[model samples]
Target: MRTRPTTATAAAAALTATAALLLTGCGGSDSEDSGKDKIAGADTGASASASPSLSSSDDGIERPEVSLPEGDNLIFAPETTGDAKADAVLKDNAEYLRSIDEAIGKQNPKSEAVAFYSKDSAYLGSVEWISGFVKDGVTVTGTVRYFDRKVSFSKDGSAGLVYCADESKGYTKDVKTGKVNVTEASKDSYVLYNDRLRKNDKGVWQTTKSTSDRGSEVCQP
Candidate 1:
């Protein structure tokens, strides 16, 4: 894990870099234009304010429930892919993304749902990512839209997914002061994510690894 900064601005930058490297597998220097609100986290007990939803797989595997903070929202477009296998992959993948936010919302780095939906590098990276939010005393607010999702299966049985995130409407709020750091929409607000997932014996497609590109031309409108 990388060292985190103490200052608010520096902390945000460090967190962004950490996410790109560990969680998203995008190794490089941090972008100056990246917004602090691009990531998600929450105050303690934030999850209690929202209703927890259970995500179940077709194979009768029941995933842990996940809930987000009141103001924080993640929207996924084209909820169903028409194909059964692809839909299953998308469902679990969406849950994986949601579980990360749920962990942040609960301020728990070892969130059950997060562990249930991911493993290996994805799991370790999520823990470190959530820890950054917990230490910063910041929580995400507003909405983050995920769209243009495409999925494919490999010969080895692993699944691949690519998607876009629109974070222009998202903001990071200071948990103590109730201050929201809002930013205008820009190229940096759009992000592209490429992920790999494998179905476990439990019938859950767990995210194994992922890579992201912020301000990628493909993600921009």
Candidate 2:
């Protein structure tokens, strides 16, 4: 049976175009039935040190104003667990994933990958894989929305978080020639990611392991 693509490594490759598997952008009009969502609300002017802002989402939630590179539009909505520990894990997880996505979109994987990934071979090795994409001049352009995140803490000071990603608007293109390889949207376009994380001495959550399941029906939520 196929292995990596059946899990998170394949999911990462599909989103970033590193696993040698190309995913066509899943383009469709937004519908409530689709369960596809957009992040809402703006930063509440809380100090940057304030993480896991448990502010209730409302009609006045202003979208954070940040410059997104063209062809890359990833929107991360706020976490609303009201549980500090859970919020901390989710917050760090979102930032870590965003850092990697931005690095790939900007073609600067080296610096970004090193910053989030652990020194362990599995996680760090993924960075090496991503570096190859940068070396090949691949640029990812599209939108991936992450949702339905759940965090479980372990007694060993480690944690695991699972989330679903909708990659309906992302694709890989060649930077030099502006050539793009697009494919028909498949079940694989919808994915679920399981990430294993541990905080280092610096209080930073580092990705120790990750896996993905493509076309996971559970992720549709």
lDDT at residue 115 of model 1 (Cα atoms): 73
Global lDDT scores for all candidate models: 0.67, 0.52
lDDT of 2 by residue, 34-130 (tens): 1111113211112122222223233233222223456676665447588877676776666566555555656664543335434343345455555
Give the per-residue lDDT digits (tens) of candidate 1, residues 55-117: 554567656777787688889986896899989888888888887876776788877777777
TM-score for each candidate, following the candidate numbering: 0.74, 0.63
Which regions in candidate 2 have their CA more than 4 angstroms from the true location? 1-68
Clashing pairs in 1: none
User: Which is the leading candidate under TM-score?
Assistant: 1
